[model samples]
Target: MVKKTIHEINARIRDGSVNVVTAEEMVNIVGELGPEGASREVDVVTTGTFGAMCSSGVWFNFGHSEPPIKMQKVWMNDVEAYTGVAAVDAYMGATQLSESQGMDYGGAHVIEDLLRGKSVDVHAISHGTDCYPRKVLDTSLSLDDMNQAIMINPRNAYQKYNAATNSSKQTIHTYMGSLLPRLGNVTYSGAGVLSPLSNDPEYLTIGTGTRIFLGGAQGYIVGQGTQHASAGMFGTLMVQGDLKKMSPDYIRAANFTGYGTSLYVGMGIPIPVLDERIAQATAVRDADITTSILDYSVPSRDRPVLRKVTYEELRSGHVELEGREVATSSLSSFKRARAIASELRDWISRGDFFVSMPVERLPGNTSSHAMKETEGVSFVSDIMSVSVVTIEKDASVYKAAKIIMETAFNHLPVVSKDNVLVGIVTAWDISKAVSQNKFDLVEDIMTRKVITARGDEQVAVVARRLDQHGVSALPVVNGGNHVVGIITSDDISKLFARRH
Candidate 1:
């Protein structure tokens, strides 16, 4: 059989004869007609998502004033904008916090206010020059006064993202929204099948230069987005568009309490059913896209995974966790997602828009690495004090207390005559021993089941162990279980402080 071409599809679209379907409709059609038959009938599938994207920002060019000052610094409604471009150009990052209002209002709010046609205070400063002598200017400007306004975002529309739940006793304020303590609520962010990249799993058609529906306006993919995970699965794209064509309804400013500002961007993509494989890919459902529920309480690159769940289960309003059904809420608006899909479908059916071929395919094997500390890794032996103030197990408590006071050490490791670590004594132990008039022996008041660290253990690992065990110090021991050094919280701080 001859394969259908994009030109043929465009011809049908131009003649008002093309069959376009929303992502939801395409799923049912593929189920009924199968991939081959659906590929022959369906010309396009429209997908969409409306979710918080913090990497979004807008660039503006203010018209020159009477005394055209080369703007060295610029601020819109007290939120700073990047003035590195030229005299009149500035870029406002969505997450840039408001200097006066803090996280409550930010650059994202400025963008939203501009889209709302509201006036904003514009403040600029410059070093005086002969041609442009104005040192400072403060005035109000609206979007209508700007020469060019464009939204250029580095990362948006993740294909799949993990749901978040707090396992710790305290609530966490994160970009995922507020995570309630002890899994009080679960929050997920993507629009599942309706998400653009989720439908186009492989960047087969959606790639650099491909036109998209961005904030209800025409936009194009620029490049691979930041944190664009490995292919054959999660994918992301950097997108840009003219803000003039966008509406405030499709793009809103959001302040994630403790996390800062982000843009709630509504975007859509039209997938051309060029072949059966493409048709099959677009037929993915909520149940097919899988992601895990992660505990954000753990402060580590590798957080603990609670459970893996399909989007279908998440969309069902509740998911089982720890033998109980937990309510789930989505940060992305499904209603708006459906509306974007429907609108994009109408645009395609009316021949107002045509799908463009990608200029180049995105890399399929790229993965992000965890950011390591610039100071580099330090082991227990590197930070541990070799001249450890040791207390003999048979030593009197009075002697131990005197040594601790003189050295100002909070903890002392009690050892045998052979220097084998037998126990650990803290200042609190000496205090209690002295209070009760029982200062006979150090071993009587010392903790026998003492935790120790190996000389080669990573400092971070040992530090975490200390935190978990509620201990301020760990005796560094060699292979023969002999105390070689001592590591305390203070020593760890000093090590990090020196490196930093």
Candidate 2:
């Protein structure tokens, strides 16, 4: 076994004097054990609260995705302990808000889209309810619904997300197969309305500890961006979250990083596949790290031993793992409605929140606002309108209504021959026009006093317009008052949310 105790390694970390080593060199160091004794040599790498500590004498000071410059030598024990504590901290400190309330879908599974970007987890059971082709379901879960929820139980880690396919299969196979026990009280199983994120290293670190690389300078999540990047030993592709971005090609080419080198990369096979290449370069065999758990299919990994769990081990079979205490003791369906309703009632009783998402970057070059303005040029003028669907002012409201039906836009500008903004039109307006259907002349029914802004206008003004009118969109007009582009409330809301 590695020499130092977790406490000793932790003390070194606390003192800012821990000796750190990377998987690159660690793998080399472990190679001495030969492929025969490899599994026994691999340390139980912990994260979140637990900091890094090697099974050997070396202090492995590290955590997942810490870039270089910020990364320094520390005992692996220290790093493991830190992560373990951090995870505990997150769980402990998370307020018993709506998320902590009651709702049990036996366990959860996270679905990720490795290429375009990460997709949010959708509960396995809820996935079906959400994508139900039957359409008999009354409602869909909102973000607030998800936010007020908690990760109440143990769950499976998933690979992909096909909303429709999963939805249908879940209802027919899993929910029906397993849920018959609950009887006819509108019961369903799998994951509930929300799919909580699975950050546990056991589920997330598919490439193993050394497989992930943290190149360049690593730092904290709140600030600090990743600097340089490359693949390393154990097929590791380093791209720390703190880094600005991770490059695929850089990871694709590199095999061996230096001893004790840090790596940060996206989480996926390319990472492990790369780590395998690096391991070959480093003369590290697969047995050097992989464990012979006998049956890799063993479930309920939080325990010390690996074994297949039977339903008989479960109390009530579908017991609400951890967060169930509150779900039963504290909340009733009436209580749930009241709790959320209380929020709405409080807002009603108190007042309203006038949130704004200006198109320009926040005051301090923050990425909060999706689109940023140049030094002088306005965001509106620079925006190139694409996939635009237009309708003439002379066209009947029915024609305008049809445009919105076939296309995605909810609003369009009423431009005259000179391309001047004669009036503003929207689906809501078209709906009103259709309802009224008073006249054939578009001008007679057109909204004459439209809320128009100059092309040079600030996105801040656009944000303000949305709030004042309680409207979903606005049109961008040129200096000659010609409609050049359009901005919608959705864009502003999404931009603002991303920036935050």
Candidate 3:
């Protein structure tokens, strides 16, 4: 058994004698030479992934202007940024929407624009202070003007992600892209065995302080990513890099039609083939990796898992689902992923880059649990009245008034013909209608912007909404915005009275 260390690999890299191969190439090399032989022949294996990571963002320190202001709220290119840290520092998340362009232009676009050497409009406002008295600052600058532009992403490079499919009748727009109705198609977003985490499934060489290729720039892994659990089939990495050194080709801005914006980051990790174990891991193929196909049509966090399918099946362009062949597609670019891995391999073979051992292995054999409410906690559905009285939008105001007179209820949910909640009509609106003698339609007198609650909402949140809106009642709706029940201030009072 030829046992080597990362130090040995670094020495080889420095002496221009290192032998490197990509994860895909390792599969073929292992097939020909076996694990032990491959480990002795190959010094390192490079892995890569190019996918939409919504958790990505950039932090900036704008050089202060004359009569500097303490920036409390900031916007770059009309997209809001968090300015809670310092007077001239702000962090803009990629998914944040633009005030003027909404989903069309967002923080991701601003980040890419800055990277592309374009000028960005910056506006900041602050409450006048004694030390920093200036209230507002508006200027245009490029990336070269910033003191620092660091990309500190909380989560990136998911080891494996569930494929998405919709079983509902209507198409749903999600981060997974538009899932066609009735599982018309499936969309996945991982690079299979070529992925960084997939090549180092045990977090052996890939950990905090691990040097990586990020957005065409040398970067480092900061720590374990959010929602990382070693016990599950999924894992993630938290990484950071200098945005100033990144390239537009490896880092791009993307906007899903209805899912706002996310950053497409190209990342690669070099794994030192220290022994047979490392070589065996790097030889993982698409057939060995498996993930579930989750129903994205379900609104809840615990979406229904349709079935387990291998990456090979997903890459084959279709998969069997409910006895039908569902077309499969990848949201992550395999072509870009292969290019990134090849780039990293070349960097290592040319002695320009070297792999490093992890400072400490990431947590392993740990399980994550779904959020569960404590005992005695109640949701709006627990106390809401199931027998809800609703009126159609096209109904007459006289009919609404008659319903209010006949029943003790003061509010009626105005719905469409398909029973979708559109508005709400209160007795006060009906009284105004009667006084004005304007009995045209229920929708004309109803409040179109109805304050509503979801069935899954906690009672405390619903109470706050009711108090904030100063509304006596709220129509409880489902995911489809169809009113299923009604919760009122009186009902909440009754629950507390009973508890007492």
For lDDT, the strongest prediction is: 3
Worst 10 residues of 2 by lDDT: 49-58
State which candidate, 2 or 3, has the greater TM-score.
3
What is the full ranking by lDDT, best candidate first?
Answer: 3, 1, 2
Instruction: Give the root-mean-square deviation of each candidate in angstroms.
Output: 6.1, 27.4, 6.2
Find the candidate with the highest TM-score and give its number. Answer: 3
329, model 2: CA deviation in Å? 67
Query: Per-residue CA lDDT of candidate 2, range 1-500, in tens?
Result: 22333344334445544333222233454367542232233221111111011111111111222111222111110121111321111111111111321121101111001111333322111112222322111222222322221211111111111110111111212211211111211121111111101111122223212222111111111111111111111111111222223222211111111112111121211111112222222333213222111111111122122222221122122323223311111001222222222232222222221111112211122121234546443344444354455556787777777778988898777878777888877777777767776537566567766775555555665677578667776677766877777777667666566656
- lDDT against the true structure, per candidate, is 0.90, 0.30, 0.92
- Whole-model alpha-carbon lDDT for candidate 2: 0.30
TM-score of each: 0.79, 0.25, 0.80
Residue 384 lDDT, candidate 2, scale 0-100: 31
Instruction: Compute the lDDT for candidate 1.
Output: 0.90
Off by over 4 Å in 1: 377-500
Q: C-alpha displacement of 420 in model 3, angstroms? A: 17
Q: Tell me the tens digit of each residue's lDDT in model 1 across 322-372.
A: 999999999989999999999999999999999887889877778877787
Between candidates 1 and 3, name the one with more favorable lDDT.
Answer: 3
